[model samples]
Target: MWWQAAGILLGAVLGAEVLGRAAGWGALGAGSREGHRVAVTFDDGPSERTPALLAVLARHAVKATFFVTAPASERYPALLRALGVAGHQVEAHGRWHRHALLLSPWREWAQVRWHPRAGGAGPHLYRPPYGGHSPLTRLFARLNRRQIALWDVEGRDWTAEQATTLAARTLERTEPGSVILLHDGPGVTPALLDALLTGLRDRGLEAVTLNDLPTRRITFWAGLWRLASSYGA
Candidate 1:
C-alpha cells in the first residue's frame, strides 16, 4: 500500500513538471539571433541603488526593462515614476520575491495579479521571482493577460565581489538576442551595468527594451535548457 502511494506521488510530481514545461513554451526567453540586438533587464528593485543604476543606463543612452516587485514599487513610488519618466519599461516581478513554486494556488494567483499602480496600460509582462514557476503559473498569466518574460543570459552580479569581473563574464556570455538578467538592488550593479554597456557597444550589440527586441516564443528545448541552466531545473 505504501509503495502504491509513493508511486502515485512520484507520478504527480513528474506530471506537474511536464505540464509546467509545456506551458512555459509560450514564454519569451530570447529574441531572434539574426540581429545585433539584446535586451538588458533588471529585477527586484527601485531600491536606493536604483538611482545610480538609472544614471549609468542614462549615460549609455540605453533603455532597459525593470521587473519590479510590488512591495518595492509601493515603498518607492517616486522611483517607479522615475523609471517611466526615463523611458524604461517597468513590468511586474510579482507581489513578493518568493518563488511561485513555493506558493499556494491562491497566493500564486495573487502574485501574478498584483501589478504596480504606476504600471502603464496594456501589454503587461511578468517575470516570476528566481524564474521559478509552478504548474499553474502560465494559467495565471493567461487569466491576468500577462506575458511571462524570461532571460537567456544571466549576469550573476549578486554573487560577484567586483563589478569588473562580473561584467566581463557577462559580456562573454551575451550574444545577439540575449535577454540579460541583472539586478537593481545589488550595490555592484551600477558599475557592472556601466562596464556591460561599454562592452556591448564594443561588440556591436545594441541593448534595447523587450518591446524593441524583435522577440519570438522560445523553442521548447531552448526554454527547457534555459530553465535548467539558470534555475537548475
Candidate 2:
C-alpha cells in the first residue's frame, strides 16, 4: 500500500514536469513560422548592467522585452522607466526571483498577480523564474490573465563562456520564430547581445520584441522538443 501511494506521487510529479512545466500547456513559447524573425527577451533586470544592454540594443536599432522582477523594478524605478522610454516592452518576472515550482499556492498566486508600478503598457506576459511551473502556476496565470512566456533558444550568457562563443552557439541553434532567453544582470550579456544582433543581421533575421513577434500556440511536439533541449543547458 505504501509503495503504491509513493508510485502515485512520483507519477504525479513526472506528469506535472512533462505537461505543466515542459509542455507548457496553454503557454506561448515560440512565434509563427512564416517570417525571418525572432524575439529577444531578458529577465531579472533593471540592474546596473541594463543601461549597457540598452545601449547595445539602441546601437542595433532593435526593440526587446524585459521581464523585470518587482524588487529590482522598485529599486531602480528610473531604469525601469528608461526601458519604457526606449520603446521596449516591459513585463513581469514575479515579485521575487524564486522558481514557481518551489512556491506555495498562495505565494504563487501573488507572484502571478503582482506587477511593477512603473511597468509600461504591454501584453500580460509572465516568465516564471527558470521557466518552471508548479501544479497551480498555469492556473494562477490564467486566472490573472497573464500568458506564460517561455523561450526556445537560451543564450546561456550566465555561463562562464566568452561572449563570442555564446553568440556563435546561440546563432547555430536559433531558427525563425525562436524566442531567445538572456538575462540583463550578467556582465557578458551586453557583448553577447552585440554579437547576437550582428549574427542575426548576417542571417537576415530581424530581432524584435515579443509584442511584435508573430506568435502561435506552443504545440505538444514543440514543447517536448524545448523540454528535451533545455536539459544541461
Candidate 3:
C-alpha cells in the first residue's frame, strides 16, 4: 500500500508538470467565445523597447497589462510609472526569467516581489515565468493572497520571429476572452505590436487589461488541488 501511494504521488507530480507546460498551468482566462473580451498581457520588460510598445498600444487606444520583473522594475522605475500612468495594468512576473520548477521555496516567493503601484503598493496579479507553476507557487499565492495568471493565447514574440509572423500567430490562436501572452522586452518590435492590435480589431476583439477581463475567484488550495488531480487522473 505504501509503495502504491508513493507511485500515485509521483504520477501526480509528473502529470501536473506536463499539464503546466502544455496548458500554461491553469492560468486564468475569460474562456472561449466570439465576444469582444481579450486581455493583452506583456511580460519581461521595462526594457528600451517598452516605451515603443506603450506608444503602439496608446495609438490604438488599447489598455493592456504588463508583467514586469523586479530587477527591471528597479532599473526602470519611470517606465513602470509610465505604464501605470497610461492606464495599463502592471503586475508581477517573477524576478527573472528562470523556470519556477528550479527555484527553492523561499527563492520562489522572493522572486515574485512587488513593484509599487500608482494606486498604492504591492501586486494583485502574478504570472510565473514561462507561465510555469509549482507547489511553491500555490503556497506563495495562498500566503500572499495573490492571483496566479496564465495565458490562453501566445505569439512567442520573444524569439527571432518577424512581426508579421507574431501577429499572424496571435490572431490564429486568439479566442474571445483569451489572455494573449506577449513580450515588451528586447525582441519585441513596434511593428509587431501595431499589427497585433490591428489584427485584434479586425477580428472584432477588444484589447483589455487583466482588471477588465471577467474573472471569478477560486480558493487557492481548492483550485490548486483540483488542477493537480485533474492532470493526475
lDDT of 3 by residue, 1-233 (tens): 99999998677666555554444344464444556788888888888888899889989999998998888888998998899899898888887778877887788877654534524654477778886766566667757766777765677776898889889988987778778888887555678889988998988888888788764343354355436644664
User: How are the candidates ranked when ordered by lDDT, highest leading?
Assistant: 2, 1, 3
Per-residue lDDT of candidate 2, residues 85-189 (tens digit)? 999988889998998767887998999998764254545888899887776787798888788888878999989999999999999989999999999999999
- Cα-based lDDT for every prediction: 0.85, 0.87, 0.74
Off by over 4 Å in 2: 1-9, 117-122, 228-233
Worst 10 residues of 1 by lDDT: 15-24
- Compute each candidate's TM-score over C-alphas: 0.89, 0.92, 0.81
Query: Native-vs-model 2 lDDT?
Result: 0.87
Q: Pick the candidate with the highest TM-score.
A: 2
Highest lDDT: give the candidate number: 2
Worst 10 contiguous positions by lDDT, candidate 3 = 215-224
Per-residue CA lDDT of model 1 for 50-160, tens digit only, reads: 899889999999999999998898899999999989999998999989977689999999999888742568688888898777768888999998888878778998894
